[model samples]
Target: MFFEGFSLVTQDVQGVRYRFRSGGTAPDAIFLLHGRPETHVMWHRVGPLLARYYTVICPDLHPERSPEQQVNDLLTLATITGHDKFVIVGQDYGAHLGYLTAATAPDRVQALVLMEALPAATHEGRDDMAFSLAQYNSCWFAQLHPKPESHTIPVPAEWLEKPLPAESVFAPEAVADYLSASIWQHARTVTWAAACHPIRCPVLVLWAASGRIGGWYDPVRRWCDVTSAPTEGHAINGLHFLAEEAPGDVETAISLFLEHCIPE
Candidate 1:
């Protein structure tokens, strides 16, 4: 659930409607992007709290968009809201956008935070075609998941402390939007491999434990060694879902990054 009094609005950006929940009085802005099988709702724990100090913008991104398209979408949202510059915190799929947006437009981003995501590729480049294929195999059904009926994919009981229906994860509209947008798992990987531009802004990467993510992507190595900017890597002991299982750790990492790495 969102913080009380927060308004949910849908804005048409380049003919595509994007939904977001926003409410805060702070002049500085913070954009939150959620990962797969989730919507902006994942930020309920930290978003309301973050709003106390910053204007929080959480948007539901359909997984189909490439890293660059996501960047454009977020930029459009920023322009609509009249925020020339803002901080961005994203998890899983959302983190990909956060990293790409920061790298693509250093001047537009005040700060960037990525939690438990695929590490940003450096200038050296990478070979993740197989990894992409593996994901494709796993989610093949998900892409075609809405053949006859469409609803939120039920969240497994183990993923959360308490069991919840997948419909409860995000709004029905958001769930439908994601199902419609989901596609081309391998193509997105190629996009990331090519999106390895040098980052020029302050970055905070909250990396999850090794076994939580892909076996091939070395989340720790590249994240710690990223020289594109002054980057800090903090290891979080949790599942792939950062905000859910390790909210306190995520909050602590964000607090430290904001307080020490970036100026308010």
Candidate 2:
């Protein structure tokens, strides 16, 4: 992957280990934070696109873990990369840490884009979806399993292209990625637990056209109310994995947003 331009560097910040992927050169950095059971690969399309214009760094934050731990990992990775200031883009669990990093040290983050994610709030955060009996049961089993499992499905690549009201929210690639990644279970649980807190930053909440996780609109609104940061919601015409499902649209939105933070 051309996005794998940055060497495999290790960072030990506050006892958290961070593995990062980098592309491009220059000090103006764009940091990518990935969610649970996933690696820097989640930004497969987005990272390279951003790298075309700015230094793109994507790090996998083993979500099933603690924010402090993830933060430590990011801190160490940043130190190793010689990045003192950067823009943070987080999705799902990654979004939580993006806010935490900015809130803990506002100086570090120039801007933040939260994709299909919300602050760490358990009660009623935007990312916290209200699942039905079947959905809740499935999630329970997932939590109970405490590890990733393979999900058999047909036409995996076109899974996202299907219309709303999907029978399954995950595609084969997503399933494989989740199961293979480290800290899968720990990341999902901790992400929800962290959502109980508030974050301060220029936040963007993206909603999926057909939400398979939980009810959509209200949670995003609630998330905006709790976080004093400038927040807006745009409904993407796809499933949860909008980046892969609708790369062009996602890239356009991201490019437009980043232009505000780093003109060029």
Candidate 3:
């Protein structure tokens, strides 16, 4: 089973159980965090692709835990894996939390790969961007769901038919997993509310040019401006999950970046 390496492990922290994919050699761990409404399953395809070279760990951001608690769980997981520092790859809500975890613990994060990540400030610094999908006539689920209590719009399979700009980057399985997981978890927008200060690590921001969330170029640019970490941004042709949509391109970028950070 490709999923046999995947397991649901429970952590004492907050009684939360997260999914992890265990494979690869020692010294380097590639942790994958899924966005809202999704779980470790979101990276089923991409994880194995990277797992061939590095240990890939994907954890479900169970809506039950707060952002702080989530990071703590990540740290505990890292400790359990015997890794003091590791690289992190995240998408959408996952990217948002990745920034927080990296910023809070620079020593623990060797490198960061963020896809369709939200600027920490965007959650509060700008209110005009928080319009509803009805008002904005766009997919503004994160903004609309300001709190955990807000309702989540179910993203059905039909939505994929009208592929967004970056659809080519991911395979059908990746998209299906994201859609199903997000729909199952009613509190899919909580991570959007998470914000952070500057971080001090190598950072890569991969934004989906066709993203329906706040695809504001300026906001994306500001993330590079505010981060103390050495940062670079690339506008890709995919939707939110660039890794799944364009695994080859993403793998190339990730491998090159990790080479400089992890060292052969």
What tens digits encode model 2's per-residue C-alpha lDDT throughout 174-243?
Answer: 5555556655544345534443344555666665677653353454675675677776667778867776
Instruction: Candidate 1: list runs displaced more than 4 Å.
Output: 120-190, 214-220, 224-226
TM for candidate 2 is 0.73
lDDT (Cα atoms) of all candidates against the true structure: 0.69, 0.64, 0.68
- Model 3 per-residue lDDT tens digits across residues 1-264: 344455556555446555555666755888988765466776766776677778877776765666677788898888987888899888877887788888778888889988775575654555364443433224444444564234434443344674643435444655565666543454534535434555778887777667744464454466766676678767766766565566677777787778787766
Q: Candidate 1, residues 1-264: lDDT per residue as tens digits?
A: 535557889999777788888979788888999876667877767777777777888887755656667689889899899899988998877887787788787888878888777664552446455444454334444456563134333443333433335534333443344445433232345345534567777888776674345355556456656545777666777656667656677777786778765564
Clashes in each model (backbone N, CA, C under 3 Å)? 0, 10, 9
- TM-score of every candidate relative to the true structure: 0.73, 0.73, 0.76
Model 1 clash pairs?
Answer: none
Residue 126, candidate 1: Cα error in Å is: 7.6
Candidate with maximal lDDT = 1
- Which ten residues in a row are the worst by lDDT in model 2? 147-156
| Superposition error at 244 for model 1 (Å) | 1.6
